[model samples]
Target: MGEPLATKHDVFQAIADPTRRKLLKLLAEEEMPVTVISGHFPMSRTAVSKHLRILSEAGLVRERRVGRENRFRLDPQPLQEIKQWYAYFERFWENKMAALQYLVESDEPVKPEQ
Candidate 1:
């Protein structure tokens, strides 16, 4: 059998940049051409497009040609990986919070020991 397919980009790495994260948030609102998307950012359109390209490679953003321009929109399915990753750590936080609550609400006398 042929080797398994490889991803062109890693979602984690793709979203590591603040600029790319802003791009994702902007696209989440509505699909827009690169020009419109670039308007919301302080950087050059080329820089914004580069960020969008990384997002597209990671499958977090979908792009399609419409008329003479490319429109981009958020495809949040890939973000499930990030959510699932955070969920693992969430359990640990919950456990810690529960323990803290128990300590705070316990009837045991407060004692200071060196």
Candidate 2:
């Protein structure tokens, strides 16, 4: 393994709110200013800011103040923990499928159609 994944605090904080998840999806495409993020939600800028703050604390989003605007971007590395966890299930399912295939093939009779 490379480095340890993000702590529970990070993952929980990142996924605590639906707004944050939406923000993450948007940021995943490209970085945008606070205004752009607020445009997508019905909440106020302050509410969005709070969501962003939570995401930042979770190490999922990075914010930089450029002049008078705050630009927010996604930090995807933290999500690798989730991916790794899911990959474990993927392998388990794959092995089960292979075993099932072997069993089915082994039980098939090699009889010609008569």
Candidate 3:
């Protein structure tokens, strides 16, 4: 099995914060300049910039300078790692839910055919 990801730049860490997650959602819709991205949140531009920096470090977003306009866009490739990691546990949840369903159905009395 692959080892767990444990680092500041891990995609999981990048998305852990609500602000960062919102930033990713915004960028996913369309690429935008840092100014526009910072506008979406109520926080100061500097705070948004910090969140962007973390997302950049995690490889979830890419930045480029276009004639003084620093634009950001979602990369999305890194998020696959996070999804794959969670899929393992999702199976466990599914099995538990299936068992609970069986118990509930069993508790209901059966009706005879007319």
TM-score for each predicted model, relative to the true structure: 0.79, 0.70, 0.78
Residue 41, model 1: lDDT of: 93
Instruction: Report the error of model 2 at residue 114, Å.
Output: 32
Q: Report the Cα lDDT for candidate 1.
A: 0.85
Please provide, for model 2 over 1-114, each residue's C-alpha lDDT reduced to its tens digit, 9 standing for 90 to 100. 865343335665578678888999999998889998999999898999888887777778888999999999998877876788889998876786575543334666644424
* Cα lDDT for residue 80, candidate 2: 79
Provide the overall lDDT of each model, using Cα atoms, as 2-decimal numbers. Answer: 0.85, 0.79, 0.83
State the lDDT of candidate 3 residue by residue for 66-87, as single tens digits.
Answer: 9999999988878889889999
Number of the predicted model whose TM-score against the real structure is largest: 1
Better of 2 and 3 by TM-score: 3
lDDT accuracy of residue 94 in candidate 1: 74
Ranking by TM-score: 1, 3, 2
Candidate 2 regions exceeding 4 Å error are: 1-8, 98-114
- In model 2, where is the ten-residue run with the lowest total lDDT? 101-110
lDDT of 1 by residue, 70-104 (tens): 99999888788899999999898678657554343
lDDT winner: 1
The clash count of every prediction, one per candidate, is 0, 0, 0
